[model samples]
Target: MSNRRDVWITGIGLVSSLGEGPEAHMQALSSGTAPVVDATGFAPYVVHPLAPISFDAQIPKKGDQRQMEPWQRIGTYAAGLALDSAGIKGNKDILGTTDMVVAAGGGERDQSVDGAILTEIESQPNPEIFLNEQLQSNLRPTLFLAQLSNLLAGNISIVHGVTGSSRTFMGEESSGTDAVRIGWSRIAAGTSEIALVGGAYNAERRDMLLLFALKRLAMHAPWAPVLAQPRGVPTGSAGAFLVLESPEHATARGAKPIAKLSGVWSERAQRNEPGAVEAVIEALINQARGDVTEGTAILSAASGAPEPTAAEVAVLARSGLPVRSITDRVGHGLEAQMPVALAIAALAVSQGSLFAPLEGEPLEKPFTETLSRAIVTGVGHWRGEGVALVERAD
Candidate 1:
């Protein structure tokens, strides 16, 4: 343990339907505010869409904004905010050395091209030949590769100057979980001094809605809280990025850390069994290597999806700690869900206060004691589960 480096959360950049920055989120959470859900736009499928933001503020270059997809722009913009929050924005010296691990889904699909192919394919005499022909003629060069998830990291590097080694993970909620896990591992192991880790999601797209709808996962909303929902609920549009650094590195730069990231654990649970996820979560919490006490709290990335959320709720029930599920406020962010939860958890611990529960679930108790520790958790709709623990800054 003596050889382990201390990992500190020095900066956080978060943007969602709730608002921008940690302060905005803090104010909203503290006030037990109503979430912004767009029921009419996507209809049947509800979305906690992003509020308006001046892209010019962060991604000032119009060309950069034009080339990147909405998710990429949101990510790049958030990366800038993280750098700024850490007092390293525009500092070429520090930015040049900062590594980044991003969790991202593939780029936006070409709906027009897709629709055209779909409409014309059935009319073709030879479906196979026509399909090939359409792919060759309709799809632009580099379109396939451009949609690769890594491009988000590339754009962040190009626009933000975070040019050190980069990696991108792509498996929904687990992707966000591992991005932070790897970033923390590197810094903790002394392989890297400082790193940026997080993800972004633009859930306002039709493609995503259709993707979820195929599995009957899309929520048609009059919009109620996650616990109140009969099943899973709305997805959200969000971007979350964090600047994590070794304690010595942060201290040398005179950057005051907001929180300490003590540990992270991730796992895949077989959904076929009744309580498999609950068992997995129990093990993950046990792996966190600390005691659950009076000052501890849980920030749940509870996907309002019934099967998993219900299991998660059961586990939280026995813990006796205050639980605040962000789903009701920010909605389920899919890939960005866990990252958003972690960012908010860091903010809550840093401020030493618990946010009022948005949904007011029966089991979610109010804590009067200042929060010193937190359990940030994620239960993926289909497969993964992860938990990370953080402590208030000393």
Candidate 2:
């Protein structure tokens, strides 16, 4: 097998509070404008930066939007933008012939139903029976059809007719990058020339919020954390997708290659394990290139979680690359982690500026004298760890 086949990201679609497209989002990030705001919709959790897409406010088609899950709606919205960016029409014939892969960090359907249940209980008096009955009837299908991580993939497949090959991964946060690695490997193995890869997630449910709080993945509120204690995953919903094609395929189609998805490195550092995270980053640098350690930017997976973020900071102090977490703008979601990383990396290549993490204060002391390299880490509950080290082409 060829060690590497030219895999280039020719097109990108993004849904974040900053903006809908890559350029717009990058501009917002570079300008130091925060898109975070109060959370709305059915999600009751305290959210600092609610990155809802512009489409969320618009009215959906009769019956169409009514039945669709929140994640599906986000995915559909991202899919449209991604395909349009590539100038590829979402036709059955076009999709049917191309090999495709869909993956997510989290499922959105269950959360939407959870939101519905909470809404019902709030609106009704003595809502236990009423909520149960509604859940039994209306929420069951969402549980059956929408809960699985692959539902959105099925929905996309039906919409576009992408029949060549398919697979889905829910590595929590790392799932999106894992899907990209798998797709890249497939293309390298001569399995498929083209692949549509990205991730979508919605944390818009009351139960999901409470669960995250229990797990210490997010905070209930700024005051709750500042006064009481820190807990839970930061609430967020996002959809980001990319069109990856081999050089020959893109060249034949007259598509401009945005940047080569040259290399990907993933590591899993359990709270109980030692050296797991460092080993992964070291391996990534070695595998990427013999000289990759010199002045490369790292698209980091530094979600707002304190422990993992600290772990990453320690690793960076040792590794020699400047670090940044892009999750500060869109807020962080597990499933969307890697896809979001990929999207920001794509923007870095296009905009000619390396993006930095928005959450933490810049290091008081320098990790190294030379700040040429940036590390983008994908941190979340699932162990789909990813680190991208990139250098400018001469």
Candidate 3:
């Protein structure tokens, strides 16, 4: 482990309900203002809406923007921001070989078409035949193609000129953790010099809200801090990406690292089994704790789901470190949660400070000392669990 190559976070592209870019997020975090939440837009179900953005800034081509669904557009836009942040946006030499890994969910559904089919199917004499005909006639070929998870990576390659090997994962929150894990591991093992990694989520979609509501996982009350909320998630729209490079690669390119990604560990626990979630989280935290130093804090991506959040809270409480929950500020981003947590951790480490507590929650105390490192943890609402260590670069 001592001889392994060091991985550095050289660039970050983050967009959320707070805003776009590192500066915007830093400002929001420093202000200690209430997170922007929309409790009325979706009615009882609260959500953190995406801040207003002009897609033209990152994606210049109208044709390209027209073809992508909302999630793809968000991811591609963030990918462009990452390349630009690394000072390699138009530099074909670097981008031509930059490995790409993306975490994504299925594409958006055409609600109007779906509604119409459901309404007409009830009247048809032979409902099965009618449904089949409607499916073949109403759905566009492009829509199905757009639904493929890899299109986010494809769009990034087309618009940003990132032509290296591409890999896409698709298991909700777990996918995001694994994507970052793979990117950091590749650089650490000398399998790749630099990589672009992240994911995006669009919570404004009715289809997604319906899906979560079916499982009783969507919040349907007034907005509150994540820990204060009951057994459900206040989903948000966000796109987060990071550019990771081997220390030698970053130094050779004159790229300054924002933070050092020392270690990343991921696991899955049988939530049905009592204490399984807590056990896995505790083990992961202990593994990363070896790198903890003075002024270290935790940035937790604890989805507001009751079971996993309780498990995470318990483990974090025992760690005896000042902790802050990312979901409180950005809302639960599902597949984008881990990358967003990692991005914020890097931002905090680079600035040598932690953000103010959310609503002065007892668990999140004020940290007045200079922050030297951060342990970012993600406990998926249902399945995955992960921990990562990020330290200030020397």
The sequence of per-residue lDDT tens digits that candidate 1 reaches over residues 33-136 is: 78888999988878999988888899989999999889888888888888889998988888889999999987787778888889988899999999788768
Q: Candidate 2 — what's its lDDT?
A: 0.62
lDDT of each: 0.86, 0.62, 0.90
Candidate 3: how large is its RMSD?
Answer: 1.7
Tell me each candidate's RMSD, in Å, in order.
Answer: 2.0, 5.0, 1.7
Which tens-of-lDDT digit does each residue in 80-168 have in candidate 2? 67777776755565566666566664443455666767776887877888877886787655443435567677766655455667788
Q: CA shift at 90, candidate 1, in angstroms?
A: 1.4
What lDDT, from 0 to 1, does candidate 1 have? 0.86
Model 3 alpha-carbon drift over 4 Å, by segment: 140-147, 291-293
TM-score of model number 3: 0.97
Candidate 3 backbone collisions, by pair? none
lDDT of 3 by residue, 1-394 (tens): 6778999999899999999999999999999968889999997798999999999999999999999999889899888888888888999999998999999998788889989888988899999998778768996554544357888999999999999889999888999999999999999999999999999999999989998899898888677666654478999999999999998999998999999999999999998899999999999988888755579999998888888888888898899999998988999889899999999999999999999997746689889999988999999988999999999899
lDDT of 2 at 187: 71
The clash count for each model shown is: 1, 25, 0
On TM-score, who's better, 1 or 2? 1
Candidates sorted by TM-score, best first: 3, 1, 2
Using Cα atoms with residue i matched to residue i, what is each candidate's TM-score against the true structure? Answer: 0.95, 0.80, 0.97
